[model samples]
Target chain A: MGVNIKNLSILIAAVALAGAWVGQGQADNEVVFPMPTGPLYVKECGSCHTAYAPGLLPARSWQKMMNELDNHFGEDASLDEPDRLAILRMLTDHAADNPNANMLMRRVAASIPRGAAPQRITETQLFRFQHDEVPAHIWKRAKIGSKANCGACHTRANEGRYPEREVRIPR
Target chain B: MMRLLALLFVMTTPAWATTPQQILDSLVQEARQTQSGFTASVSRGEQFYRAKQTGGKEADSCASCHTDNPKAEGRHIKTHKAIEALAPSANKQRFTDPAQVEKWFRRNCREVLGRVCTPQEKADFTAYVLSVK
Candidate 1:
């Protein structure tokens, strides 16, 4: 019976160790943000531009963006009240400032000043800092028209994974 | 026999599924209710699609994003996103849903004309796109 208990303890220790290792692996892969679900969010927002990962902005920024959909940037992206609210919930639930946000998303939220809600993710300090090395003319490339086009270089932008090795700048 | 009939109905008409012709016909019907003797014109739709408007942004028109050729794939002027061809011949999924049809008309018309498109304008635009090969 004592030998069986010892073996059981060893098995439990191995499982705990494996769990910790997996948790560490997840933390290291912080580039992957949570992708928003629902057909409405994808179709309505993605039709015009990239449906950016919700973790790219804070909850407040998303709230501001949702509120001003009638004059979104320079275009009208108005949605029905229910749809707008649904998309808003999806965005805020996974926004950078969300309590359950991952490390990378936490950094995104931390970079922005308190009470400052920026509509454009490209205009964020972290985004600019990350792409600081990229020349101004690179954004004007025919294949990479604007900074808003994250998938132009980050091929896995759609999957919410922006790994450095996966980036491929178009000529 | 009833089960067979139900299956046949489902196979022929999926829920919320629509065709370009059906969508255009419905738009025409709506326009007629608003304006008696209303008739959708392919030529008028072509003109509307090609005409530059001054109400919204400078040089904005349906052609600005959809391109002059509805059969050709277009790119978003600002985001550079690839918009599939608008013509039914080139893209089978152009006007398949009534809701999707209304959504784009509401958005593009406001962007280019700075106002919601009238039922007549929507019908004309559909007629013009359907005429494209």
Candidate 2:
């Protein structure tokens, strides 16, 4: 009876180890947006909000956004010529259509309509599909004002970490 | 001997950090070159800071995002991002860098006033912001 109990305990331990390994493997497969390392990009783009990962949008979307910085969304976000071109280059190099772009970026590229150009990431179908479970009322909470404020719940969002295990929705 | 020591102390003191006054002076100088009699008035600056216009699609005036008080921390009306106080007294790093100051002025003026801010307007705005102690 004692031998059977010991064997059962060993089996449970092995199963737990295998589960942990599988979990780690899954995490590795999940594509995280890479954060920009340039100082100009960090200051100019990140000052107002998270310097959104370039891979989130296709090259055409980025080009459209770059060309219209004077009326970027609702506000003027214009940059000097040299700085603008530099940022544009950086953005296009890592855009969703790039061969080196990750799985998440590829998914974003695939989800968009053939001739449609979207300005906001939240407007994308894939982004909506991923966040469909979240209640609409939760976004109005004072601590988490809008969808743009990703750092509100994604603690490591600034660092480009957005794993499901790290999300902490504020009350 | 004591006077000389005091002078030495003053000279040796690190003046590397750009001050709000220095930036304001430079803006005034730049404004003077274009407008012969340009002189920044605190009252005019304050008025500009508060005035609302029908230019922007989202934000109407500087006050819409920066709030009525420059000394107080403001929030981006749409994004809800917290903007640091604009007053030099409230935030030490307010107008330290020339590039940073120019960047905001360029974008914000277009957004709020529907045009690039003139040197005189920039000077007046700086004067008003600095006076918010």
Candidate 3:
């Protein structure tokens, strides 16, 4: 059993090393949000803005946001009880804590402090760190009116393809 | 046999979407139930749509985000997301779904008026929007 455990550890280490090597230059290239499949989620959340990817935040954040929909980010975004429950289920299922979460989700989960569930993805430390190079004025551009408008710079934001290669800072 | 298939298709197909007219009619019914002889006023609806109110963090009127012209596409002041024209004539999909209509009303009314809108108000608002064409 000791020998088997040693072998498993070595195997995991090799895989991690390989991943690091492949991800070295592509560090800036973020994993795009897989567009949510649920029609209700799309209709309800996407009606106003981009249906922000669920994997971007932990389960706690999703729960907090869903519970306080009446005061959602200064706008009343209340939902019927049944629809709210359905959307919440969808968000929590793909949340950062999911076992098969990608690099972005894993990083987000690691960075958030205990008992602090941020409603906005832009509030996350990782998001700020990733966008530190951007000047504050850039977010105020006519085309890129706000930092929340990911599609303004991320060409395929709606399709969840936010690769750095595709980014085009709109004037 | 062909007639039976057509009948089956009509029976099985669900009308998930309720038209703007249907929504307006339903609102009228609701308004009349509470207030006898209550007729939707397009002018009053227009006033309600453009009226500015306090208590909200950002834009006060439905017109603030929707723009003064319901025929024109509006922008979310904070998020910068493009809102399609509210006029049914300009945007065919506007007010097509019952759930969509209710959801926005529940949110927007609370934001603009700081409370839930009455059925009469909803009817008037719908009538005003529908009249824009």
Candidate 4:
């Protein structure tokens, strides 16, 4: 009975050690902003432009964008009713204003005024502050057509990771 | 067991999988139903493709983003996103899916012409793209 007890204790210790190791690994690999996953969101929205992280905007902004899809940025991007609602749910659930949003996303949400619902992420104060160093002429480059083309400079924008080290302005 | 396996295989296969020719034929049929003697015209399609539209933000045409040559790769006029060639000869996946074909047609026609395209226009446009070698 003593031998069985000792073996059980050893197994418990091993399991505890394994759990700690896994927790440490997760902490080490945690990204600043994890990518949202939705096949319809990528297939429909990503087809035209970068499928921006929903954490970039508040829930109100996403609502407005989804409602005005017919005249989206001077282009017709209207989706079927089901697709529109599904994407809206996905966007609002992960928006910066969402309770489960990360620290940075909360900061982004706090930066905007209470009443204002900015349509473009490029128009946001945080965006301007982040891109203050970039010259105006850089945005006009043929390779980087406009501010909306995040993937032009951010190599892994599609993957939803935008580390400063990954940026490569095209000539 | 063999019959069960065959049933499972058939269930797993997509019923919507179709060829570009099949989609084009259906669009042509719809056009004929709308107009008694409707026939797809490649030259008319080319003219429609190249015409400069006035209603939208800019004087953008189908050629604005798709370019004059359907076989060559094009870029999104604003976003600069690289678009695949429209011609079936250059890109085998051009008109394979009915849903994708309809979605793009609905969006692009409205963006360029300020309205959805008729079945006749869709048929002629498909014929023009399919004709390109």
Whose lDDT is greatest here?
Answer: 1
Error of 4 at A79 (Å): 1.0
Q: Give the TM-score of chain A, superposed on the true chain A, for all candidates in the order listed.
A: 0.88, 0.81, 0.79, 0.81
lDDT per residue, candidate 2, B1-133, as tens digits? 9999999987886544678889999999999999988889999999888988776557788898889999888877777667788898998878988778998988888787888899998999999999887
The pairs that clash in candidate 3 are: none
DockQ of each: 0.68, 0.47, 0.60, 0.63
Order the candidates by lDDT, highest first — what do you get? 1, 4, 3, 2
lDDT of 4 at B101: 94
Candidate 2, residues A77-116, lDDT tens digits: the string is: 9888999999998888878787877777788889888797
B34, model 3: CA deviation in Å? 2.6
What is candidate 4's lDDT per residue for B26-125, written digit by digit as tens? 9999999989789889988888888888775553788898899999988788888767799989988778878889999988888888778999999998
Query: Which predicted model would earn the best DockQ?
Result: 1
Runs in model 4 lying further than 4 Å from the true structure: A1-32, B1-16
* Per-residue lDDT of candidate 1, residues A1-171 (tens digit): 566988999989999999999997785575888888757777877877887899999999999899999888888888999899999999999899999998899999999999799988989999999999999899899988988888889888877888888999999
The digit string of per-residue lDDT tens for model 4 on A31-98 reads 34545685777788887788788888999999999999988988889899999999999889889899
Local accuracy by lDDT, each model: 0.88, 0.83, 0.84, 0.85
Query: Docking quality tier of candidate 1?
Result: medium
Off by over 4 Å in 2: A1-31, B1-17, B34-37
Q: Write the per-residue lDDT of candidate 1 for residues B3-108, one digit (tens) a residue.
A: 9999899798864478888999999999999999999999999999999898876338989988999999888888887778999999887888787788888878
Cα lDDT of model 3 by residue, A1-171, tens digit:
566988999989999999997885365246765556847776788767876788878999999999998778877888879888989988898898778677767877999997899888898998898899999899889888888888778877766676777899987
Backbone clashes in candidate 1 total: 0
